[model samples]
Target: MDVKKVLIAVDNSTCSEKAARVGYETALQFGAEVALVNIVEPVPANVNPDLTLAPVFLETYDNSKENSDMLLKEIELKFAQGTKTTYLSTVDTAAHGIIKQAEEWAADLIVIGTYGRTGLYHFLMGSVAEHVARKSACPVLIIPNKWEED
Candidate 1:
């Protein structure tokens, strides 16, 4: 698809490794650079319905970003097909963060793995990859999770 820049969203899972390899190969074939992205989902605040909880959630968000950075680094080390990697960690909603990273980097392709949820559960909870594909400006490629193999 004439990719000039690609973002591979990694989560330290086996599915992520496949997406990383695919992104790397596509980047190499298109003379593009690969950006490794990790989005930290902030932990929900402790509910009291009595006191303010934003402060607690704020701390959780900060910690989540740091954790995401560590995961991104670990994933980068596992990248085999290409050497080009830029890491990005954001304390935002997963889908939003991924889309923002792709936009900021001017990426031509967004590659990620689907958890492969189905049935009523999938309809109710939604999925990050599907959200990105529906909203992203660039092409979004979602590699189905290798459940049987991994």
Candidate 2:
């Protein structure tokens, strides 16, 4: 495929860095632009009357956003060896946010990472990579946490 622009979704995990690195190298090899995407996982709304809940909720949300931005900057610097990258951030549910940004940006490829959880853990958490792979109009590549020997 002639990759025009690639979107790479990143988080704090090593898996996310692997995905970003692979995406960056692919963009270099294919002469495509890479965008480092960091989706800040939003906290649930506080509907209760307790005011004490506000602090925890706000702190968690802000930290998520800050962490996401930091991760993007870290990966962008890592990829600076080859790629001139664009970094983007959004606050939302991860899976939907990625797809929406891919569509909005008109990216030709979407790259993400999975923790590779399965069985009960996967069933309980559901898979964001799986959801993006299912819903993305562009091609999606999910880099599992486990490394294949190749």
Candidate 3:
């Protein structure tokens, strides 16, 4: 398939760093444009829908957005220098946010990292990478956290 556009999903984590490197390499190999996306989950509805408009929530949201922007910029500088790239930061559920960005951008492929959480933690938190892989319209490449090998 012609992968003209690649979406690299990242977070402020070592796993994401590894994924960023792999994703950049993949993009370089394919001569594809890249877009870095970071998802900042919004305050849950159970936290009080009214609080969504409160100053506290707004401040938290602003902080999250700023952090996401910084993370995306840093990843771009470190892994995707000299490549045509875009930064996408959104406040939504992680899986949904990544999927939405990929669909909106019409990405040809998606590269993401997984924490490899298992057992109860996996059950509780779920896997963003898995969700994205299953839901994305295009292909997905998941980078596992291989700290020992690194």
For this target, which candidate reaches the highest lDDT against the unseen true structure? 3
Q: lDDT for every model?
A: 0.83, 0.86, 0.90
- How close to the true structure is residue 56 of candidate 2, measured as C-alpha lDDT? 73
Ranking by TM-score: 3, 2, 1
Q: Candidate 2: which pairs clash?
A: none
Evaluate model 1: give its TM-score. 0.82
Q: Name the candidate that leads on TM-score.
A: 3
User: How would you encode candidate 3's per-residue C-alpha lDDT over 70-127 as one tens digit per residue?
Assistant: 9988998898868899999998889999999999999999999999889999998889
Candidate 3: where are CA atoms >4 Å away? 44-52, 147-150
State model 1's lDDT.
Answer: 0.83
Better of 1 and 2 by lDDT: 2
CA deviation > 4 Å runs, candidate 2: 47-60, 148-150
Tens-digit lDDT string for candidate 2 (10-76):
8888888888878887788888988888888777767458645677787887887788777788888
TM-score of candidate 3 to 2 decimals? 0.90
lDDT tens digits, residue span 1-150, model 1 = 588788999886788778877877778778788899998876767866787776778787877778878787777676635567888878678899999999999989999988888999999989989999999999998888863333
Of the two candidates 2 and 3, the one with more favorable TM-score, higher being better, is 3
